[model samples]
Target: MLKTVRSVSIADYAKSGVLILPLLSSRKRKAEERRGKTVRKKGQERLLQGNEAIVEGALRAGCRFFAGYPITPATEISELLSVRLPKVDGTFIQMEDEIASLGAVIGASLAGVKSMTATSGPGFSLMQENLGFACIAEVPCVVVNVMRGGPSTGLPTSPSQSDVMQARWGTHGDHPMIVLCPSTIRECYDLTIKAFNLSEKYRNPVILLVDEVIAHMREKIILDGDKPIDIFTRVKPTVPPEWYIPYEDTPTGIPAMADFGEGYRYHVTGLTHDTRGFPTSRPDEVDAFIRRLFRKISQNFTDMQMGEVFQTEDAEVAVIAYGCVARSAKRAVIDARERGIRAGLLKLNTIWPFMRTQVEKILHTSGCVIVPEMNMGQISREVKRVNKGTAKVFTINKVDGTIITPQEILGKIREVC
Candidate 1:
């Protein structure tokens, strides 16, 4: 009953004329246990930079193609993907410039791959044209813009949220966009996944806005290995190749996307096109195309809008903010509450289509809405527009490349209260 288990070499087994099947099986089981332990270790919680979290999130979302150029505060994303993407059988390309980066991404997405690209402010400016093209052509892709102090490469390493307006309206034409801003490292991961999902579901591009402060800063995060993430892939055409129309409008306003070389040969162009995907200069066709593009996003904004409200139910003063600046606002609200002031925070995780209903509710209920941002009141203007004389809107702005601290926001809360 006390038989000992010992390792036997292949040579020893052959010399002793013994069957080595049992010993080989034992070794295989031990090896598998060691591998399982290694995998578990790899999946355990660890500290991660925001940029690194973004790369992990994209990979988890089944992103198979990435094309981006080197840019500050965002180059790390491209670098990490270069190594990790190959491991997942994905492709990574360093394009000649930001324009080509987005072009390559659009091409890859058209080829039926979930693709993404990352850049900072300067590079972001360069990609606006193609961004609009992705919108008009109904190509689903994700673009990450890491904010840095900028107006033509102002400060590459410094944090600034000056691109809020640009993220919304940088392109030339009247197009709809969904922009998600994350306040923490964990949010950087979660929102990037959401960006991909929303883009695919809507058949348009989605922007993930990250500032320098969050992008480069390191923080510990608990990544739940058991949590299931909902992934949305583009709907493929069910009809035969001859019956497929790439731009066939549906009730949902999203057309079925057919991959190239899938027997569905359809045209795609940045110009206004018809259901068959051919360019049309007719005014009615152009009008219909534009309206459908806008309707797809504007009508479905309710499903796309996501926000967080803390202590807002009965508060007299509500603070509305987003991005990394919202972190300070949350702390300010908690501190104000401790000091017997009824203060709350409305954190906008989805910045575009502007949370009009939530802001209206907050304005009607609260005596005043205080918006503190790192930029010069870009979103505060939207808050004021939504408030519409119902409540006084106050903005606290800082654009000096420094983060808006909690104490600064608390002071504003005290003053407003």
Candidate 2:
């Protein structure tokens, strides 16, 4: 029997400090059964790990170069690419280390090849400096960080969401960053393609952040191989080689990129450069360069800051979550509704360049908002910042190399309501 939320009452839960678990109604049971049944799509449906789906997405998105070091949890990405890239006439290299891996990827992209690299926590840390170089150079490339428990290879194979802050701040200085989180196997494939498109369109390094759970989890998904997918490539300079300016700012703030050996001699550097790509120390030139990078992304928030809202139309309470933990949050929301609570959920797809406007609206509307993550309040902090006391903010943080359960989130909802 199903019960609508708060039907069991705060007083009832308070007496025992436990939410009464209700059996799913027949309708609910049928829905679960439908999800469990395998698809019968011919030549399209197959079981794949999240990491493997990413490789497929990359190939489909026209990724031709992959240079990476083998690291636990992320090793499959490199391993699979090595086999797949060759079949497609693409290039793949096992670099000496993470730093060199990104360096190679940067070089490949500069030569007009779509390139990428994958790494775990420690390797991600090592790539930070090189990643900063990519940002300043405005190189179009992709970096996949398969997060694992860590401070110093803390738990190489265990799951953890502690890298949320690191992904945004890992590189020394602030330029523009795009970090995406995928919660499902299908998203792993779709977002990887989207990541490549965004990188080429913006001529910037894009990070695809995947934790252990999603990276290794296996599920049935349709590859959609026959679908006509939209792909974006960097705009190349049509001007004569002698007239090309590699870093010239445009109305969209994205400059036309030229391949290194395309007969256009342009300097690429970590130093602040102007239109000619030559290092400039002039105050005005540096200011324009930095502002242009920020403008290209910030001005395009609608296309960049992506998220999904569930049951929020009439919701009085909401749960904000992302990555694998979002699955749990969704289940909790449905259960809350069954128990007669008007609860909702918001799952963030873009981690950085936070979705502030949508979050602010939810904060203003909901009586209370709960943010549950694998890290200790990393995203919750952002929610609270946007809150401004519009709604009471609560957090359910877990960082013990384990996941936060739906039951755990329900308990918090029960207590708060």
Candidates' lDDT values, in order?
0.86, 0.86
Model 1 CA deviation exceeding 4 Å by range: 1-43
Task: Give the range where candidate 2 is weakest over 10 consecutive residues by summed lDDT.
Answer: 13-22
Candidate 1 lDDT, 146-248, residue by residue in tens? 9998789888778988898999999998999999988878888888998999999999899999998889877766564645669899999899999887887
- The sequence of per-residue lDDT tens digits that candidate 2 reaches over residues 1-417 is 011233233343232212223346667656764886322344566678999999999999999999999999999999999999999999999989999999999999999999999999999999999899999999989999999888897887888888888988899876889999988888899889989999999888999999899999887777876557889999999999998878888889998999988898889999988888899999999999999999998888778777777778788889988888887887787789889888888888899889898889888888699999988789999999888888999999888999889899988877898
Report model 1's TM-score to 2 decimal places: 0.89
**On a 0 to 100 scale, what is the lDDT of residue 186 in model 2?**
82
Q: Candidate 2 clash total?
A: 7
What TM-score does candidate 2 get on C-alpha atoms? 0.90
What does the lDDT read for residue 293 in candidate 1? Answer: 94
